[model samples]
Target: MIIDILAALFIVAGSFFMLVASLGVFRMPDLLTRMHATTKSGVLGAGLIMCGVMLFFVDSGVTLKALAVMAFTTLTSPIAAHAIGRAGYFIGVPLWDKTVKDELHGRYDEETHVLRSPEHMQDKQDQP
Candidate 1:
């Protein structure tokens, strides 16, 4: 009876997280943040739900399959998220400007760093 109750609780909790993650994916301002929320919460929510189902069911084969599914999800979710984020960046998805400091900005000379003017060196030295 207690095991059943615990399993129910886990499933409910996992479902809630999954719903929240879906909401976040919809409501987040940018692709990167959405990916962050979806990837982390989706993986954890599915993992917990699978654990709950495994605990609640008595069939060994079903439990093993669920475990395998959970394992695969855990392994691939982050990779998928990373790929999406990289694609977004490559495709020029605008970042939340307030949240990021791009250190790479203006640091390089496209022609050649060695050919930079003395004024550029002076500007760098002037920065405290």
Candidate 2:
């Protein structure tokens, strides 16, 4: 009885987070913010849903598969989101007008398409 209740709660919470993620994608002003919402909330929702599934099943095979899937999602989602965001930025996707700051402003080289750290830029300036 307790297990069922716990599973139900997790499932409901997961569904709610998934809904939030969907809303974020539609409502966020820019690509980066949308990606952030989808990655973080989506991963959490998936993890929680898997947890509920694992609990409800109470079987070793289902539990193992659920854990494996959860692990994969946790590892890949953030990296994928970052790569997409970086690609968008490289291709000149504009940030929202109200953005507070752009940390990558002068750090990225257009010609080489490489991002240099502040220390590296400083060292180059010192060399010349």
Candidate 3:
């Protein structure tokens, strides 16, 4: 009885967070922002849902599978988001207006695919 109650709570929470993540994808202005929302909340929601399912299932095999899937989701979601964001950036997708700052500005060299911060840039400039 208690397990069922706990599982229900987690499932509801997971569903709510997943819903929020979906809404964020639609509402956020930029790809990076949307990626952040989807990756963070999406992983969290999926993790919670997996936890609920694991709790609901007492069988060891089922629990192990759920855990494995949760682990995979946790590991992959952020990396996937990062790859997507970086690809978007390198492809020249415009950032949203009112962006406070671009730390990558003047730092990245497209040809070499290198990122150098101010100190590195200064050092290179002084070398010649």
Candidate 4:
């Protein structure tokens, strides 16, 4: 009985997070922010839902599959988000107008397609 209740709780929590993530993706002003919502909240929601499903399953095989799915989702979501964000930025996707500053402005050299910090921003700013 307690286990069932626990599983239900996990599912409910997962559902709530998934709903919030969905709303965030639609409401966020920019792609970067939407990525944050999908990567963070989406992962948590999926993991929690998987946990509940794993607990509810009596068969060992089903439980193992659920665990595997949860692990894969947790590990890949952030990496995928990062790749999308980097590609978007590299293709000259604009940030929100209210963005304060871009720390990556001079870091990426198109000639080499590499991002490296050269000591400090102040050092670069001090130069011509």
Which candidate ranks first by TM-score, i.e. highest? 2
Candidate 2 structure quality by residue, lDDT tens digits, 1-128: 99999999999999999999999999999999999999999999999999999989999999999999999999999999999999998899999999999999989999998899999989999995
lDDT of each candidate versus the true structure: 0.84, 0.95, 0.91, 0.88
For candidate 3, lDDT tens digit of each residue in 24-116?
999999999999999989999998998899889888998999899889999999999999998898889989997899777778899999877
Instruction: Estimate the lDDT of model 4.
Output: 0.88
Q: Compute each candidate's TM-score over C-alphas.
A: 0.78, 0.95, 0.92, 0.85
Residue 3: error of model 2 in Å? 1.4
Candidate 1 wrongly placed segments (more than 4 Å): 103-128
Report lDDT (Cα) of residue 46, candidate 4.
90
State how far residue 4 of model 4 sits from its true place (Å).
2.0
Candidate 2 structure, TM-score to reference: 0.95
Q: Which stretch of 10 consecutive residues in model 3 shows the poorest summed lDDT?
A: 98-107
Candidate 4 lDDT, tens digit per residue, 1-128?
Answer: 88899999999999999999999988988888889998889989998998898778768998999889888998999999999998998889988788788778868888999887767656878999
Per-model RMSD to reference: 6.4, 1.0, 1.4, 2.5
Sequence-dependent TM-score of model 3: 0.92
Give the local distance difference test score of model 3.
0.91
Which residue runs does candidate 4 get wrong by more than 4 Å? 120-128
| Order by TM-score, highest first | 2, 3, 4, 1
Instruction: Give me candidate 4's TM-score against the actual structure.
Output: 0.85
